[model samples]
Target chain A: MAVLLLADVNDGALATDAVAKALSAVKGLGEVHILVAGTSAAAAAEAAKLDGAAKVLHADDAAYDHGMAEATAALIVSLAGGYSHIAAAATAFSKNVLPRAAALLDVMVISDVTAVVDADTFERPIYAGNAIQTVKSSDAKKVLTVRTASFNAAATSGSAAVEKVSATADASLSKWVEDKVAASDRPELTSAGIVVSGGRGVGSQSDFALIEKLADKLGAAVGASRAAVDSGYAPNDWQVGQTGKVVAPTLYVAVGISGAIQHLAGMKDSKVIVAINKDEEAPIFQVADYGLVADLFNAVPEMIEKL
Target chain B: MKVLVPVKRVIDYNVKVRVKADGSGVDLANVKMSMNPFDEIAVEEAIRLKEKGIATEVVVVSIGVKQAQETLRTALAMGADRAILIEATADVHTDIEPLAVAKLLAGVVKEEAPGLVLCGKQAIDNDMNATGQMLSALLGWSQATFASELAIEGDTAKVTREVDGGLQTIAVKMPAIVTVDLRLNEPRYASLPNIMKAKAKPLAAKTPADYGVDVAPRLSVVKTVEPAGRKAGVKVGSIDELIAKLKDEAGVI
Candidate 1:
């Protein structure tokens, strides 16, 4: 049985790290085939180079340009007959697309899979990572969304054969109007080696600059507690928590964060955690590898200058 | 136009869940249960649409145990016109799979043909963000997920979605599904007067059999276990010590 791995395309190129990480998860299941469905030939070229993939199925079409769930799900369903498993990176893009495909296929999707115990069995986090549930799917075809952070990215070395796939009929349900993504050279929050995150205690929107400056100094990504994002101190994409993006990096720095259980659910997997807050009794200190009882407003500036 | 909002009853967000000793599942006994936080935001958005005259009525639905009636009343107290409680499972620990829930909701949608179906992006309990998207697929409707800003314009909706990179704006035709994000709006608390008024509001109870959708589990739970906890680490005296430990001891930076 072969596994169909969907490759994520971004900015007319392959989302290399995301696709590689997703590939790592499915490679263990069976013969891995990468599906590159977008308006980019370069993305297909990139997918054809992933080491473990046996083949790259490329569908170059304008219908897939915006990555609409309807179009992608239709294409996946059209090609679902041959594969035993259909998988993609558990991201917002795939999160919106995969379940729909699963419903259309009359199967259940194992979302946010952290481990592949076997072809039919898997492990996933439930209750915001408070508990882990091992699930075994009984459906004929398995649909999955792989949590990219749990596995290492697949290296690019082997050359897999590229096969052309025809685009399916568009559902014509949604349209892309505009996307407002603030350009930043900093590494993405989910994959960064280090993440410097702020909380509501960081004060207003202007005071948030201290956290960003520290992240820049450390060459890390900027993140925020749900409180900081809800308070308008940070953008929605900057949120890192149970409801937002889950990140597991080499080093995670929490400044002024009280470490609510929801906040801890997202970052507890980091190898090293650092907490700086005026409140000595803050719960964040409990998990931090290095806890510094200090005011973030003053400590952040000093750390940035010294670094 | 009418708006349909689906909510879920889950363990309250404030309580820290504990895995049962036998590995069956999280201990739900004596646990506080409430409407999922994201679904609360969804109900609030539907009510706002009704108040703005964009919608003529707001209907809320929940598919779970009979006690989910409490969750529906909460939505009614918040300003929903009515509710439907589809009692699917008797066991509290048996969480209904998203595929079944979506199929049942599709049945409900066919019966009550609302112009829009608004729901939480994901329930906080299962953390399975699939129902709304699956429902859209079964019904063949447009979907705009992770919406931070949404406006109804003529026959279409202009939605600003929170994506991995940043915010994305999309135009979806009517009869769509919009799963709300946290920043959509601050959900309002039920007032004392509204709480009193909610008891008299219509709440119809049904079963999964009524919709001809089986609530059987397709995925078997092999085991449930607590996630490995992080060991407590040392507290540093100052910033210099912290940076030194990260660089020298941890080799992270």
Candidate 2:
């Protein structure tokens, strides 16, 4: 009947701009409903303020605090009867949750959709964004994971009514342990306005400071290529690639990074791309808006000094 | 305590993929195919579990074209105790959606009754990171997606997941499905002798009908095309020039 969207919550509020972008994705399909399934009511309240949503469904529960896929997916499936389309931002959160709900509903999920062609047709990147596939689903209900970068964020200018949802999703099969999330003063990689990334050229773990110094100079988030992460030059969370987090920031600076196709899939959509590397033949130069053929060790420090 | 791992045959990660000139799909003909990089990690993790005495056997399965047998053989060489190739499709282009694959795997899980199932978080070809989560749902079991670190203790598994912000650890009951991420562990290379030994290992060929699962296409491909390429811009000489371009020309700063 309506489109149900799972809200991405942070602490007690809507997480970043992802939900607003997801709202933009599900807006014209049907009656837009935002489902705030979390441990806090503040997130539901924030969802109610989103302009496009017709209503906010709040399912406040402790089991959802950790955002466990099992409980969250069960909650979505319990409310599946009232919606024709179920969607969420294609982050690690919803990626872990939505497909479970889709399988429970006996429907196929169109993961990381970049375009909504009508209600059933969607465009998604396949083969690490080297090829774009437009697919048409024949399922009764369409389950989608919206690639938020593909759409603009919906404005927050509405006072949609909030309804309470009483549902018990047993999460007895799983238990939340602990999170070792890096608590940084720097901007979050996915939501930052600018991102500075490093690669194997950044060299050892200690040498990643050059990339961080530049990121700090620009007040940007720090990111890394799969090469850097695999080499232990950076943490796994800092990876930016097809298998990693995707970002479409306004400014993306690649420091000593070779632009592998998988790496390009993550940040090729950036408005301004700056590549600082010694190797002129690196594929990153092809996509760079500003290419500097210089050693990043010297160039980054100099840039930091200039800034 | 057998650990089941599902591997997919995909275009090698090292190979640059090319979209078909006709724009129907990616050209798979004459392309180098290998076990998905992530699934190789899964197979390696399963074998590690057996080596650690946490699992008694490592069983690997691949659901795809007949060519996928090569992918399974690679897994067997990597140390899987046995292999199963479910020939789901004849055409290379007929990409069976995750829902169908999960259903078929769920059937295998019922028959094998492994203590755990480890799979790649997503396939390299489709980039659909849904199978493990879907399979967990179909089995009505717990799931830990994007797992980077996993440890089995008694009847539970403590998995450290690679989430957006950071690593989140969770403990799931046994007979769970764990979808692995990039940082899980380095996949080992199949040694020459092991590769030879793998050829003698028990390899079984099965069909979707054997599992009583319908392998039907739910999504129709409208078309596939190469993404718009970004052109190389003018190279700036100095830091000042780069800063000037960002502030004056681009205004992104």
Candidate 3:
């Protein structure tokens, strides 16, 4: 029951949270090996060795620079013969690529898994976290993408052998172009302990700044509902909903956000939820542990001043 | 170029799905059903392509129960030229599998030979998100998933997809599959006249048997249960009171 984890890297560094969580996922199954596919795998390789993993496999190739699903899926499919379970952090990258590998292997992918009950049994959220489903895979090989927020990070120290694997061909299905990611010094919305989110009721981008100020005061991350992101009040990455990142922070505050079912799907698991809105029936108040009905413009400033 | 859009009938996005007490599955009995939100975006994109003259014809295909015909008609009302409904039964192993859906779609793709295949990123029901990718691999065609923008040129389709990091643009060869992200396009409302006209559009019915693909449950659901819920807490009178509660009672601060 060997496991292969597709490592998520950023700016030449390996994303450790997902890998560590994934390491904990396949804990009792067997030895875990991580795949680092990128242009410069040096930093990621060095970091993977300390992931408490059995081995680190690096495929240094320019074709994988953008993580175009076609090439990355092919690379994993070719290497799929050795591993009993193939897993990745359920990020945009893994969500885009793991299914491709599963298709090539003629198996169905188990997505956003929260717990590994056994070698073949897994627990995952369905119907937007309102329901929990446990599945048993009859397929010989299990292709899975795990929700990183649900698991603890594996310890950071260990010595594992590093192996250089050959790169696969470019699928040429698509080419990478320019990017416009949000650049902020604030904590990342998904992993932040405290998340402060805004919605369309924020009025405009200028109003969204108040949400950010309160987040800064609380040392929290800024999140936005789908409407806020679509209304251009926040960056696309700031969206927290069914289509966006699923976060289970310690504290979640909704400012001017009338919770849509999709938006609630992403953050309902938070330890504590507080809603501040003028609309008492905004649906967000239904799940909020503490509800404050007031205009955000008035409420946010007061909260910021208090913090 | 002819376009192929595959749509799915899923639990309406607005509906609050309830897990059955018996643990069979999510209670779908008498629940409102609608087009998967992402698939609606795909349908809208294909219609836009047709309206722009980049595509000459748009064919909408769905694989599900007989009720799925309504989903196809909605696509046709939006502007698809025709529809195909692959008949499915209620049984999991004997009737529908995600792979079976892809295989049947491959048959349609072979027969229609559309230059572009558009579909949703995933269905809300199982959330497997693999059908389009599986179809692309089965056809040996290149693919672009989570596409937010699309532009068609000679023998190439340049697509911009939404990723966690940011938007990424890629060019896949013609005759490829593209899965739509939520932001791809806002679907238009079907006018009363268009809804009537969609009823007259050509709709063909087939089955997984026609595609010669095996239909069996690749994975089994062992148990289904309601997720743990947080109890409703007291409402705070003031901002200061909320802060005190957070620090003292909740201890999250």
Chain B, per-candidate TM-score: 0.98, 0.98, 0.93
**lDDT of model 3 at residue A168?**
66
Superposed by TM-score, candidate 2 places the C-alpha of residue B41 at a distance from the truth, in angstroms, of 0.7
Model 2 interface DockQ: 0.89
Candidate 2 per-residue C-alpha lDDT over B64-128 given as tens digits, one digit per residue, 9 for 90 to 100 = 89999899889999999999999999999778889999999999999999999999999999998
Model 3 TM-score (B-chain only): 0.93
Cα lDDT, all candidates: 0.92, 0.92, 0.85
> Higher-lDDT candidate among 2 and 3?
2
Q: Candidate 1, residue A266: CA error in Å?
A: 1.1
True-structure RMSD for candidate 2: 1.1
* DockQ, each predicted model: 0.87, 0.89, 0.71
List, in the given order, the native-contact fraction of each candidate.
0.86, 0.90, 0.70
Q: What's each prediction's TM-score?
A: 0.99, 0.98, 0.96
- Cα lDDT tens digits, model 3, A1-307, are 7898898876566777667877788766778888888877575556565556888888888787777788889999989898999999898888878887888898888999989999899999877777889989999999999988787778877778778898866656677766666677888777789999999999999889999999999999999999999998987878897788888899999999998988988998888999998998888888999999888888899999987
Docking class of 3: medium
Comparing 1 and 3 by TM-score, which wins?
1
Task: Give the least accurate 10-residue stretch of model 3 chain A, judged by summed lDDT.
Answer: A43-52
Ranking by DockQ: 2, 1, 3
